[model samples]
Target chain A: MSKSIFYHAGCPVCISAEHDIVSLIGAENVEIVHLGDNPGSIEKAEKSGVKSVPALVTPQGNVLHINFGASMEDLK
Target chain B: MSKSIFYHAGCPVCISAEHDIVSLIGAENVEIVHLGDNPGSIEKAEKSGVKSVPALVTPQGNVLHINFGASMEDLK
Candidate 1:
């Protein structure tokens, strides 16, 4: 199963967490979508009930993970 | 005088606004600093009294502009 991570490039926390995630999971395993690149991301986020960036969606599409400023250890 | 814009990559609003600013001022005229790139950004933001991302600082260092989800028109 693949994991997709949707994030905003302009948010500090999101960017920081993304790097940590990449470090932990390796960039190859994670598919990153930069919200700023897509204007429709807001609507997608709303549909997915996303209130913040750095949201993680599992390949099965059954789990949605929201991080409210996670530590490096948590990310790892 | 140069203009420096500081922003976070994780926040949706910041990413949205940063794009607007880029579209408005042109990428060359704007010096964008992604806060996630620098761990010291938090301290810099605190010292500059920044409560949010997409903060713009003028060359003279007299004016600090903070964008709270501005429209394209406002950005232009």
Candidate 2:
């Protein structure tokens, strides 16, 4: 199974934390979509019910993450 | 003073309705920032306390709007 992570590069927290998540999850296992650079990204985000940034979308089309300026521990 | 509007171009509603708002307010009166294309956009959004897309930012750095799939009339 593959996982996709959608995030806006404009968010400092998202940018910083995404790196860590990618490191932990292994970059090969995840697809990173920078919403800021892609016009169609939000459509995917909305379809997956994403209301916030640094969100994770699974290959099954489920949105499973949100970043609210919380720490890494809180993220888990 | 100029007013700024921050929105993600990836959002269908934001893209569609921004045109109207621009027409209503006059393009010269507003600054449209496509957060999806700008890396620093969300920082400005966070400073304005925006938690959603299609949000409007005023010259005074106030976030004044949110689009929740409402119609034009309902939006006003």
CAPRI-style quality class for the chain A–B interface of candidate 1: incorrect
lDDT of 2 by residue, A1-76 (tens): 5555645445676775566545434587677876667646666666676666666555555543433433222322
Q: Which model scores highest in TM-score?
A: 2
Cα error, residue B32 of model 2, in Å, equals 45
TM-score of chain B of each: 0.63, 0.71
Worst ten-residue run, lDDT, model 2 chain B? B67-76
DockQ of each: 0.02, 0.02
Against the reference, the lDDT scores of all candidates come to: 0.50, 0.55
Worst 10 residues of 1 chain A by lDDT: A67-76
Candidate 2 — what's its lDDT?
0.55
What is the TM-score of each predicted model, taking all chains together?
Answer: 0.38, 0.41
Off by over 4 Å in 1: A62-76, B1-76
Superposed by TM-score, candidate 2 places the C-alpha of residue B74 at a distance from the truth, in angstroms, of 36
Candidate 1 per-residue C-alpha lDDT over B11-33 given as tens digits, one digit per residue, 9 for 90 to 100: 57667555644543457766776
